[model samples]
Target: MSTRTSETTVTFGHPFRLAAIGDAQPAGTYRVVVDEEEILGLSFLAYRRTATTLETPAIAVRGGPHAFHRVDPADLEAALEADGKAPRSV
Candidate 1:
């Protein structure tokens, strides 16, 4: 897997709890995608995900299953800078 390329679909058998987001994703099927790259035999995973289901909002992001590169931490600043946007304070 590339540092930002692993992807898959995952459905929650029960209500899934996301402590980071502080939201309990209801029991339902969802697409779980992980963006990470492999470097020197080490894998760096991203917390960001393209979680999707057959429903509202995130449909664009999580609607159809597709491949996308994960945004690596090292590249984030440079990318944002190139985009002419201020880096997020957080």
Candidate 2:
């Protein structure tokens, strides 16, 4: 099996909470990392998402080690939608 990773940033206009994170997070841009595995034995190449994570403390925060929390894609999308930001496809 083969895998690949992708990273992107998401901005929240208001504080939000993710079930996985267990706390309200401040409004800011956060780094989102996604891991996908390549599907084999197919006529067309494709990938399936294996995991998704959000960087805690926002990316702008400094002076501390950032923690990545595994988050559900739907939960993140709902959070973003509630924040008035369209969730970008990860």
Candidate 3:
């Protein structure tokens, strides 16, 4: 079985950033950059590409112009395992 892998090198911190490259309701390609490690994912919008790249007015949210459903490392591991695309040790 072949696998797919993506590489990201940004560590995440409080108020990390996520980039969705498509719609407003998150329905397309997405990227989350945290701690220099990027996690590629999907969404349900088209214009939400900048969801995590800026500051929005609080309490005036619009259901993501582009956003990522925060995922835990363990869950991420599971995803990588499922696809057999986890990075290898050098």
Candidate 4:
């Protein structure tokens, strides 16, 4: 069994955190997410075990749930304008 001992909150550029946790000996990685209003989301990704004990895992922004080509800021702005939502501030 495992339990969370510590947690760090980040609220700057992105909205997520990477945490690595595991048994007392081994550790695993988990991506934690919080919404703009600060609500915990889902947890995923369980890779195979390694030889050495695992340490803290990594966390990152969701970066969207779909894959697509990168778009320039100007183009993204135009897209958002077309969609009627204001361009993102960050």
Q: Judged by lDDT against the true structure, how good is candidate 2?
A: 0.92
By lDDT, who's the top model here? 2
Taking the tens digit of each residue's C-alpha lDDT, what string does model 4 give over 1-90? 222222222122322222221112112222222112222343853332111111122234335352222223344334334445555521
Superposed by TM-score, candidate 4 places the C-alpha of residue 32 at a distance from the truth, in angstroms, of 17
How well does candidate 2 score on lDDT at residue 32? 95
Error of 4 at 71 (Å): 1.2
Candidates 1 and 4 compared: the better one by lDDT is: 1
All candidates: CA RMSD (Å): 13.5, 0.9, 15.9, 18.7
1-90 in candidate 3: lDDT tens per residue? 223333342221222222321222212223433323233463532221122122222223457554344444444333334444554221
TM-score of each predicted structure versus truth: 0.37, 0.95, 0.29, 0.24
Residue-wise lDDT of candidate 1 within 1-90, one digit each (tens)?
334544344333454444232344455543434443344443654344332212211223455544333333334334334445565421
For residue 40, give model 4's deviation from the true position in Å.
37
lDDT of 4: 0.28
In terms of lDDT, model 3 sits at 0.32
Name the better of 2 and 4 by lDDT.
2
Better of 1 and 2 by TM-score: 2
Arranged by TM-score, best first: 2, 1, 3, 4
Error of 4 at 49 (Å): 36
lDDT (C-alpha) at residue 78 in model 2? 90
lDDT against the true structure, each candidate: 0.38, 0.92, 0.32, 0.28
